[model samples]
Target: MFRRICLQLHWLIGISAGLVLAIMGLSGGMYSFSSELIQLIDPQITRVSPSNAAALSPAILLEKISQHSPYVSSLSLSDDPEQAARVGFMTPQADSGAKKFEQQYLNPYTAELLGKPASEDFFRVVLNLHRKLALDQGGKALTGAATLALLLLIISGMYLRWPTTKSLNWRSWLYLDWRLSGRDFLSRLHVVLATIAMLAYLVFALTSLSWSYEWYRKGLNALLGNDSATISKTANASRAASNQSPSKALDLAAVWTSFRTEVPHYQKLILLLPSGSASTVQILYLDKQAAHPYANNRMVFDAASGVLQTHERYADKSPSAKLMASLYALHSGSFFGSAGMLIMMLVALLMPVLAVTGWTMYLSRRR
Candidate 1:
């Protein structure tokens, strides 16, 4: 009876989510090695000369790019030291009045602008489509639904994999017969691979869902005591103080230098430039010597006065916050480096097989 219940749940979940899972799995598989693919497709963009004593300032780089296109939006620096620095700007469309945003590569050492890429650049388009679901409303919804379904599939899959029989045999648990018929062989392979891929699928699904669904994100935030109301109140208080009088301008470079000096052991530094009305610069540093990359330390600096706003070493984060942050790293397989990424790729590849095998099983049973 228990086995029968498990099979029914598994089949129902698989059938409902199969097509969406296949699409997400294939797209995710493509994105697994996107960094390498980007390098291979556009070697020039990835190339960077050694930084000289006269490295370009962020303000100067932004200023030069603003000359050609005045509608400057946001600028981001690549964390990868090997890659050329990038500045993005919003420019007025030539044919239409609408604004369009694009990224430009720069030589950090010389601050020289490189040639703009053609609109048809392969890797850029692929990553955009993969991330934003082809920039279509329907596509995004479909992907979101797929992510939710993936979560259900993982739950049902685990139930199915749980050992139900009293007698434990190697053949039943692990072995697949080479001499078996094609249908049987495929079924065994699908079940085994799905079992192995379950945890990865769950991590990817939850993270994607957190991005896609507001309720999930809010719920997660609430669980971590990071309620939206608290954030809003904090922002409002900060804004009120700023409105009272002009705040002192903060030196972003000095803030970064101070952070580095304070945390001398960190290997990588990521600074997120503030946008909209926000007045804080978030700095994240990765300690390579740490057991896990997700445990990297983080600090926030006041954009106006360069005063330390928040200092949250990964170890200091609330348990729930730490779990959520770790999920981000795990979903991308960066938590475990190259081996983890390769494992994730293999799991992604097996998803299609699982879907195909599931349908085959259904059809055979109906016959």
Candidate 2:
């Protein structure tokens, strides 16, 4: 009875979410190599030689950019050290009441403006489609449903893959006999791979749900002891202060120096400069030596005064936030670097095979 129930739920969820899962898997596979793909599609945007000397100040870069487009929204520096700095601004069109925002690049060292980087790269588009499920407004619901389905699928799949009394032998665990024929071979492969990928799938599904549902995020945060009120107050205070002292200039270099000094082990650092009316500069970086995968730290600074407003270490995050963040890192394989990412990409590509084989096994039994 238990076995039968498991099989029914497995197929039900698989049939419903299979196509969506396949779409996500395929797109994820493509996105796994996104960095490389972006470079190949548009060499200019991806390639930039660092300045032989120290780059121009953020103030100078902002001044030059504002001269060309005064209504700029925000400017952000590339997290990738090789990439040039980017300045974004809004331009008003006669037909539209609101201005359209765009991004431009500049040589950090020379402060010379580079041509606008193309946003329509192939991999980027694929990533966007995958993340949003290609449905815009409906995408959120679809993605949420798919995530829930995946959770069910993972649980059911584990049961199907569990070693039966007859299959406890070494041959059943590792290899499929050629003499056993096609059906047996496929069933074995399906079960084995599904077993291996189950943990990763669970991580992906749960983290995705955290993004789609506010209740899920808030509930989880509450469980982890993240103070909602404190976070809100901090955000509000940051905004008010920025508005009051909008003219005060920030020292980007000093901010970066302070961040590095504070988090000396972080190997990769990304600084996002505030533009227009915003007073906070955000920095995100990964601590290579951290014990946990979600050890990517985020710090927000007062753009006007360069005062450190919020410094959130991975270890210091609320338990819920840490879990959520770690799940993302694990799912994306960002925690493990290139080799782990490749493994995840391969697992994503193999998911369709597992899904199809499971269906085939059921159909064979039904007939």
- Candidate 2: the clashing residue pairs are 72-89
Residue 224's lDDT within candidate 2 is: 76
TM-score of each: 0.78, 0.79
Write candidate 1's Cα lDDT for 275-328 as tens digits: 446677666577657546657565778776667877867777677766766765
**Which residue pairs does candidate 1 place in steric collision?**
none
What are the RMSD figures for all models against the true structure? Answer: 5.0, 4.3
The total number of steric clashes, by the backbone 3 Å criterion, in model 2 comes to 1
* Candidate lDDT (C-alpha), each: 0.67, 0.68
Segments of candidate 1 deviating more than 4 angstroms? 51-54, 71-81, 92-100, 115-135, 222-312
State candidate 2's TM-score: 0.79
